[model samples]
Target: TTGNISFRNETTFGGSGTVTYRWLVNNVQVATSTDLNYNFTVPTGATMPYMFTVKLEASNIVGCKTVQEKTVQFNPFPRALFNVVQARGCAPFNLQIGNQSTNADQYEWYLDGTLVSTLHSPNNIVLNDFDRTYTLRLLVKNQYGCIQDEQSVQVSTYPYLKAEFDVANDLSCNGILDVQITNRSVGATTYTWDYGDGSPVYVGNNPSHSYGRQGVFTLKLTASNGFCSDIFTKTVSVSNTPSASFTSNVRSGCNQLIVRFRNTSINATEYLWDFGDGAFSREENPEHQYAFANTAFTVKLTVVNQYGCRDEVSATNFIAVSPPPQANIEVAPARVIKVPNYSFTFKAVTTDDIILYRWDFGDGTSSDRSEVTHKYDRFGTYKVKLFITNRNNCTSVIEEEVI
Candidate 1:
């Protein structure tokens, strides 16, 4: 199609007379008028090398004629056409767009009236969310001028499916876990589960599961809604119960007996000890002392694991402490004995298990017996010393003077 064409006369003949115009295309008279404007359609399939020409002739009343010619070259306007590929189902909608315009040198893409890309063909335009509408536009232009042709399309989008779940009662005793799962997902029609413990796969919205061993397990849940699918995972922990037991170095001893305690508890991290003598300890293994004699003490051990599982063991009257030996000395010789070689009998009187008795006669002589007879050769106020020991390796001593 050809647009309008105009001609102007700028001749000045001292004051221009009446002017006439004639327009011709390719030596053929096409229009004749006194006005300066003409409009016509250029014939299609015109060859190159100036095959068509337009000429304008102007004349005044003085019989002067002037002619002008211009070679016509036709360039058709660009047509903007495009094809859109719309993805209906899913959260991230992928769109493929292609430009099919003729004689286009540049292109622009718009989404929802906002400029997105400047390319001939743009692919994978992603959109998220559900029940939304978007407007896509393609603007194409040629290298001739600033003219542009545009085309728009409206696309409907939907959301993709997802899966999510949470677990309860994951911790249990003796490697038995009764797990209860809760599903919290949207846009899903089917669900599947992988318990990660070599167990059978489960298919449902919410399912109860059981584990046979104590360990950390990974739980997986997948949801699908025919068009898309998603997966969610979590970790669960199971603990082993703790066993509490202990041993002592010595169960019965004398006073001030230092007892060494050994803890034999399994799967225990923390320990508490009660020595039953108003004493306590937090160490795993400890040594304790019994201060008073003839006393019985009950010892207790409490253990705990990482999962807050606790166990306790106690031995009633597990320790016995005996008193030390006491030494009592007596002599049957009077202080006023006039005889120089008088014999004196010594004895020990105390409630204790006497293992040995040591007697010093104050004459550079010693003896080991409970009762002893010592003759004083010279009775000049002799001092006697007695030492006694018990079965608990405890000892005591006493002293007296004799004449």
Candidate 2:
């Protein structure tokens, strides 16, 4: 902040007024400006623990002058960086991490997720980046006695087999079931995923499987690079039916929209929401606004149980944030859409010089014009949605069918 800090001062000539200006870097005799204003420039490379002093000297007469000083500082202790993952050689959290520059000696390591580095260390600790979380504290000696600097490595959770059992790894889902596991963890090999059925596959970490019948089963996975095993589980309640429900939308005052969920979960405390705004909401209940009118949005939710297992649910008509009357929505056939495949258009009713139009077709594919033309991508039926709006700022939906 050394550039130019401009300000004006007024003094009632008590015995003739006069003001002198002086600029000093680190309190050294730098310069003296004749005018009331000055352009001050402090030398760069002055990092933490450094100061810039600017003083204004005012004299009221014979050797009677008062001085006022202001000090400024830049670049306080470098910000903390944290990122830990399951994979080896993975980058630090957000890749902003680097070697500590605070010149320290003692280092401590902690596990089990974040902060709370319970164990203290006095040596250069070689970290195991495969765990859930790893944070370190470096005890450096300076003017500040044994200062501690910390960094974290978020080990990637990418799975080696693509699919992991949430209950028993060595478990089953019964009947015809497909399992989807995420691959973000780092450093893993040879995933032995068991569907607890008649057969198991030896492939990637997240793979789909099927069972011959419905009953109590165990799921398991043995992954290794010949060094150690990283296992994860779930209990199968395999019946003839799978039940779950998506959350409903809430309307708040001041045109605010609050959305929440009531799931059909056996056990869960975590959830992920895709509000369809290109922006995602992250709680069981989230609030948003409809600043823009006539918008349409698609929302998705996934819940995780205490067993470290997660699943996502997608419904065709989950959310609806549309644009500001860019297009109109309309349904065709006016009744039912036949299974298999069909196509249709969404039209706007009023003129108001309607500039544009968009159609959600509701079957997953939408038309992007004032009058859209679309068809069903797969067999079966859909609630084909057509949203319509006029240039004058009015919105409405027309639902129909294509059998």
For each of the candidates, the C-alpha root-mean-square deviation to the true structure, in angstroms, is 10.9, 31.4
Q: Model 1: how far is 292 from its true place, Å?
A: 2.7
Q: Which digits, one per residue and each the tens of the lDDT, describe model 2 over residues 1-403?
A: 2546553444233565565555555566555654345455546675545566656565654667666677655333333333322234322222222344444433344443433322223222334333333344322233334335556444332222222344223333233445555444345666777656668455676665655565655556656655555665554534333323465654221123445555554445677777666766656666555453344556677776543445677766454433433333444544355554555555555534555455655566667565655666776555655565554444556665554
Best by lDDT: 1
Give the candidate number with the greatest TM-score.
Answer: 1
Rate residue 170 of model 1 by lDDT.
62
User: lDDT tens digits, residues 1-403, model 1?
Assistant: 6667675645344556787778788788877764446565666664321235778787878888888887755565777998776536466777776678977888888888888888788775666767688888888888765468888888766565678887877667576888899999888898999999998899898999888787888999889887678899987767888999999889988889999999999999999999999999999999999898888999999998886678899999999998877766767865457887888888888888788889998899989988888888874888889888888777777999887
Q: What TM-score does prediction 2 earn?
A: 0.25
For all candidates in order, the CA lDDT equals 0.81, 0.49
Model 1 spans with C-alpha error above 4 angstroms:
1-168, 182-204, 218-236, 305-308, 334-343, 376-384, 391-393, 400-403
TM-score of each: 0.50, 0.25
